[model samples]
Target chain A: MNLIVAILSGAVVYAVSVLYAGIGETFTERSGVMNLGVEGIMLMGAMSGCVTAFHTRNLALAMLIVILTGAVLGLIFAFLTVTLQSDQTVCGMAMLILGTGLSGFLGEDIASKPINLKFTKIPLPVLSEIPIIGDILFNQNLLVYIMYLLLPLATFYIYKTRWGLKLRALGENPAVLDAAGENVFAMRYGYIVFGTTMMAISGAFVSLAQTNVWQEGMTAGKGWIAFALVAFSSWNPATLALGALLFGFISNLGSNLQIYLPGVPTEIFSAMPYVATIVVLIISTGNFRKKHTAEPAALAKAYDRESR
Target chain B: MSAMNKFRFEKREKQSALRTLIITAVSVLLALVCCGILIFSVGSKPLKVYETMLTQVFLSPTGIKNMLRSSLPLMFCGLGVALTFKMNLNNIGAEGQYAAGVIAGGAFVLFGPDIEGVPGMIITALCCFLGGAIWALICAIPKAYWGVNESITTLMMNYIALMILAYLCLGPWKMPRQNTGMTERIPRSMDIPEIMIGDIQISVGVFIGIIVAALIYCAYKYTTGGYQLTVISKSPKSAQYAGISIKKNILMVMSLSGGLAGLAGFMQYAGVAHRIVENMPNNAGYTAIVIAYLSRLNPFTVVVVSILFGGLQNSTAYVQSLGVPSQIATMMQGVIMIFVIAGDFFQRYRLVIAKEGKA
Candidate 1:
């Protein structure tokens, strides 16, 4: 039962983190831009959040700092890829290196230092009584509940709102939005900042909730999984949540199996998340091929309004 | 001056070549400044550190040899990456392929007889090359057939390779009766022989790397295959209309690229490290990617760039001797890569004020 509790705790945190990343990526992709810098953006957030938390020992303030730092990194990426019309791949790759270097260098002294936040956990008195489901859902950190709330909010924001429509329109055909007299760059920038901020929060969640101390390269390949989940869910927020949960489950399974199945090669088990990501990417791409649907027409293209 | 001449002032046409050169120069300058700041922050004189780094890499004979030795794997990995980039394929799996090559080469060393003379070395080299190419082909084939994103595939493969390497080090391949998680020393018979010139000992691996670079340069400069790849990269649609098979080309180039990286692993075992160890390439795979891009994916230029970076890597220990953390060097590499990439914006586009009615 305690093992189950441990597994559940890990899964909840993992799901929330991945959800933040996936939702953020969906926003960027909707603006007809692919920010491969999710990993980098996450690093920035993790560092900013961890450093703040380490010194102040305040979890809430640390979260705020991480979100703000994410916004700045996102804006920089947006300015480069959207405003400057640079290659998205190169920009993303550059940002990845920059983020990793910055975080590792800045966070070097405090990487393993313990600074517990004593994060608040929420539980329903009656709901917590239910056996399996109660432990899984009713008893989790406030962030987990917040993630659950944001899942629907994100879905509504993308599917129902006028701004969401405009964002999607850019992905499909920026010329249409341009013809409609919308400032495509500004619109894309808005989404990029929003998305980048979300990614940072996701990174911060790991440090603030799951563990108190920050480690170098701690995000591992979670950023990539978030990127992959965007496609796995076919860019739908609801589906994205499901995809993230599934990924979290796989991750949980890998770690859980580490103790139960001691005879198994832990190395192979350690590779589960990345392998699952590759499998998801391949499978999702295969589905796309089967459906014969094209990605957003303007995806990965930098629009130069003056070129014509 | 006539009124017509006065009004007909010619606008300067953007010189693409000049733009590229200027951006590269600016990026390099920025990188140096960043390194300078980092060194200064560490309470050391940046100039002194750089001098030590340079003198150790270029001025001393032993230093030059070490630089060349360190450069061997980088040369192969850089060239491999360059070849893939030339074809517009992102093969980020060189690190994985190198790991696989080590596994294959190590197996031969541990399992096969310590055959004497050049035959042993030749067989080992062939095995390593084939090992890398075969390992690389796994990803290439899936990417070609399934439309799988090679970037993710290659990146994931790196983890898988790392795990496999870990398993080998810790499991059945673990050194017999040894506490350390390393294979037994490879017999000297299976190793590449060191050459002596006067008082200097030159490893044959460096010679092989230089020869490979020369060969790659020739291929890129003169061969039809190279021209085909160049054409494909510039405009894939045109190549297809011209009857070139994109799938076949992708597979072929990726395999060749992987094979080159594998050869690095082979040489490392045969000439340099002489045994399979943990993190053998260290960050060489990633560093090679940066070097390949800095050289604009030109095979010949890649050779020059590799040496420059290899020198930096060789001088890292020397830089540490200056009381600065050697990790600063890695940070410098990352910073340089960022500036190099961001510098592309200035090369491809120029800022201009909006003309009348353009907005």
Candidate 2:
């Protein structure tokens, strides 16, 4: 019972980190823009957020810096893929390289140093006392709490509202939206910047809330896994949050299993998450499962109003 | 919104090679300037950093040799990446494939019969190629048959490959008496001879890379397989209509690409490291993507660009002495790739400034 509770609780820490990016990437993809550079942007956010916390010792300031860094990167991506008509894949790769290098170059001085003030787990007043479920779900940092709220809000925003319909239309066929007197270019830029900012916050979560120390290339394929989760969720924000926790549980199973099965090489356990990601990705996409995919119809295609 | 409307973009009818070259050059210069500013912002002298970086990488003997040495793997991986890229397939798992090659090739050297000279080299190369080809084929099946995204699957496989490598080094294959994750070194006979010119030694791997690139260049220009890939990439529907087996070609091309990257792992043992170690390829696989892009997927240009990019990586050590981070080279690569990607847009479209009333 103790071990099961321990595993379930430990899964939240892993799930929360990726949940931010997975949900963020879902939003970006839903808007018909594929941002493969989530890994890179997350690195930048980690660096800037770490540096900010070290200097100011203020979590709010660190988060602001993280969001700003993400915004600038998103603008660059939007300009390249949307305005300049560059290939989204190439541009995203460039963003990844740029983020990895730029963050490493700038964050060299601050790497590996722990910050004074990191986000601590805060139990809610009433919710914290509510049996086993509360212990596993509610006893998390501020970011986790925010995510709990953000996930549902995001789902409602993407599905239930008037703007949600427009957002969906922009992805399915921007021309149809344009024919309805809407600005496809401006809307893409908005959702892209907003989505990338979410990814940046995801990185800040790693540095400020989770690890409490800054490291180079620290997110360590969490961003990529988040990228996979976006697909696993079928591009739905609600399902994305759920998938993050499930993938988290699966990835953490390796580490937990190593305790019971000591003789087996740890690498086998460590590799479980990535191997599982591939299997899940294959299943979710098209083989031996439902042929359901929510991939945007106009995804990765540059919108040119002038061209037929 | 009104501000964005000030500029109009028109699609270019045809792409000009010279225009692309000029744009690429300008973008590189622009990225350099940005890096210079970044260096200055960090309290280091940008001019001093660049000067020492250039002198060390270009003029010093050790720097030049190191530059060439680094270029060896880049060339191999560059060729590998360029191959899949030409067919519009993104096989970013060269890092994992390189590891697979090393593990496979290293296993043969450790356990197989002790052969010497040319025959030894041939068998090692084949073993490495088979390893990479098989690893690539694992993911290719899903992509070819079921329309799975090759990019994500390949990237996911990289972590798994590294894990397998980690298991080998830390478990059964751990080097005797050393607590590190490294396999036993290959025999001295397996090492390729290096030609010494003055204080610099050039590994035969450089020549092999050039030869490989040349062979790839010829195959794409002259062979039926190359023509088929060209058709498949340009228009998949058209290729299907013409009876080109997309599934077979995807599997074949991906394995060939992985095999080339596998040879890069061979260069690690034969030319430099002499033992299969973790993080062997480093970011060479990732860097190869940028190199392939900058080279416009041309095999010949891939070599030249790899050497230059290799020099950039080599120069970082000199710059680091002056308080600049070694990551400056990596950062500069990101900047350069962004510029080149942006530069590609100019070739496809022409930007025009239009007055609002003109509409």
Steric clashes per prediction: 0, 0
| Model 1, C-alpha of A30: deviation from truth (Å) | 1.4
Q: lDDT tens string, model 2, B43-151? A: 8999998899788897788888888888887888889999998888889899888889888898889888888677898899899988888888888999998888888
lDDT of 1 by residue, B247-286 (tens): 8889999988888888888777777787788778776776
- Top-scoring candidate (DockQ): 2
Q: How does model 2 score on DockQ?
A: 0.75
Model 2, residue B60: C-alpha shift (Å): 3.3
Q: What is the DockQ score, from 0 to 1, of model 1?
A: 0.50
Residues A275-297, candidate 2: write the lDDT tens digits.
Answer: 88888888888555656567899
Alpha-carbon deviation at B127 in model 1, angstroms: 2.6
Badly placed stretches (over 4 Å) of model 2 are A287-292, B1-7, B196-200, B351-359
What CAPRI class is candidate 1? medium
Per candidate, native contacts kept equal 0.35, 0.79
The numbered model that scores best in TM-score is 2
Error of 2 at B21 (Å): 1.3
lDDT of each: 0.79, 0.86
True-structure RMSD for candidate 1: 4.1
